[model samples]
Target: MKAAILDQAGKPLVIGEVDIAAPGPHEVLIRTAACGLCHSDLHFIDGAYPHAMPAIPGHEAAGVVISVGSEVRTVLPGDHVVTCLSAFCGHCEFCVTGRMALCLGGDTRRQKFGGARLTRGADKEVVNQMLNLSAFAEKMLVHEHACVSIDKDMPMDRAALLGCAVTTGAGAIFNACKLVPGETVAIIGCGGVGLAAINAARIAGAGQVIAVDPVPEKRELAKVLGATHVVDAMADDAAKQIIAISSGGVHHAIEAVGRQASADLAVAVLRRGGTATILGMMPLDCKVGLGAMDLLGGKKLQGAIMGMNHFPVDLPRLVDFYLRGLLDLDTLIAERITLDQINEGFDKMRAGTSARSVIIFDT
Candidate 1:
């Protein structure tokens, strides 16, 4: 199978043939259909996040099951599925407690002492899989727990976003924030995730949905996605504008951009007893917090992983939402490119112009 291999940090991924092993026990092999290029993958590409070299980096994806291991029962060959990075071990404490997304997923992969799942076809050198899925390749071998069967009617390109951006954004609102009808929301970014949050907030009956971004086009797109209002983050008083629009402060503020300033703004525009959910993956050394007065005012700040998702359940429902026309996925896709155009897709993301660029595999 051909895959984009990252040999070094801050370098382009090399497209070459890779050897993918057959499914192990509890694993599933998928014929990759579509994979979304996400900012999280860019973090590893730019060396912001440390990862093993010669790894295939991509997680947000949807595909058709080619085969499954002897023990796999969640899906069968010919089933359509969306892959998630938050693979969970069913017996773990987190899974038992209904926090499957937090499961360490140690049992989902072969033990370090075991043989590699992927290797270079040329030299037989092992190639690390990114986020347990590595959907950038022509095929992916992942734990059955990492994928959820979805409707076959759903487009693979759109379903790919549900794996990450949609789940993370809508999950933040539905799970982390537990947003109720008539509550006000302020989203600190208008990328794929932020726009999804905006759409979810509207569907949840939020009284007001404020979208914030420096990009005019994104702000406009956010409005189309259901944001009742849009604020320019580059303005002199972006936070103040949010507070003013909400008549004091928003009930929930979501930080979708992994930046210190955006996270801080999410905290800044929260109402008393309001919650600020930081959905972005900030730097390890970065610290975002509220001042003493804000805490005294009962403002709460929290971080969400994969939108606190339970992919097995949430992903299927999200697919339904799209199928019902409740979720606007049509506008979310900015471009559809081949595997060879993967780097250009990331370039569009870095430029902050495209909502999402999906790689459509010819299977």
Candidate 2:
């Protein structure tokens, strides 16, 4: 199989052929259909997040099941599925507590003592898989729990975004924030995930949705997706603008750009007793918080893992939303490229001019 391999941090991914192992008792084999380029992958490539080298980096993906292991009954050949990095162990304390997203998913992978799932076809050297799914390749072998069946009619390119950007954005609203109708929300950043957050806020019936970003194009795009107002993050009084627009702070604030400043703005524009959810993958050394006065006013700040999603249940519903024309997956996809053009796709992402670049496998 052809895959874009990341041999080291702060370097371009190299395209190469890799050998894949057949599924184990609890695994599934999927023929990759489409995978979306995401900022999370960029973090690893730019060396912001640390990971093992010689790995394939990608996770947001949708594909067709080619085969399943003996114990895998959730999906069968011909089933269309979307893969999530948040693979879970059903019996873990997190899973048993209704927080499946927090599962460490240790049981999902082949033991390090055992042979690896992927290897360099030439040298037979073991290649690490990123986030368990490694959707950058022509095919993926993952634990059954990492994927969920969706409607066949869903476009592979669009379904791919649901695996990460959409799920994380929408899940932040439905799962973490539990936003009620008529509430106000301010979202910082209007990229793929930020736009999805804007769209979901509208569907959740937020009375006022404020979209904040430095780019005018993204702000314009946000309005099209359902933002009631847009603020320029680079403005001298951006936080003040959010508070003024929402009539003295919003009910909830979401940070999607993964920056300390954006997270700070999310906290700055909150109303009394409101909550701020940080969805961006901030630098490991970065620390963000509020002062004593801010907390004393009942304001809260917290982190969310993969939008605190319950993938098995949420993914299907998200597919339904797209089918019903409620979710704007079509606008989220900025371009489509083949596996060989993977590096170019990442360049576009770094430029911040595109929403999402999807890799379409020629199946």
- Tens-digit per-residue lDDT, 36-146, candidate 1: 999999999999999999899999999999999999989999999999999999998999999988999999987666578999966789999999999899999999999
Segments of candidate 2 deviating more than 4 angstroms:
none
Per-residue lDDT value at 284 in model 1: 79
How high is the CA lDDT of each candidate model?
Answer: 0.93, 0.93
What TM-score does each of the candidates earn? Answer: 0.99, 0.99
Worst 10 residues of 2 by lDDT: 108-117
Count of clashes in candidate 2: 0
Residue 330 lDDT in model 2?
A: 89
114: Cα error in model 1, Å? 4.1
Off by over 4 Å in 1: none
Counting clashing residue pairs in each candidate, in order, gives 0, 0
Instruction: Give model 1's clash tally.
Output: 0
RMSD values, in order shown: 0.9, 0.9
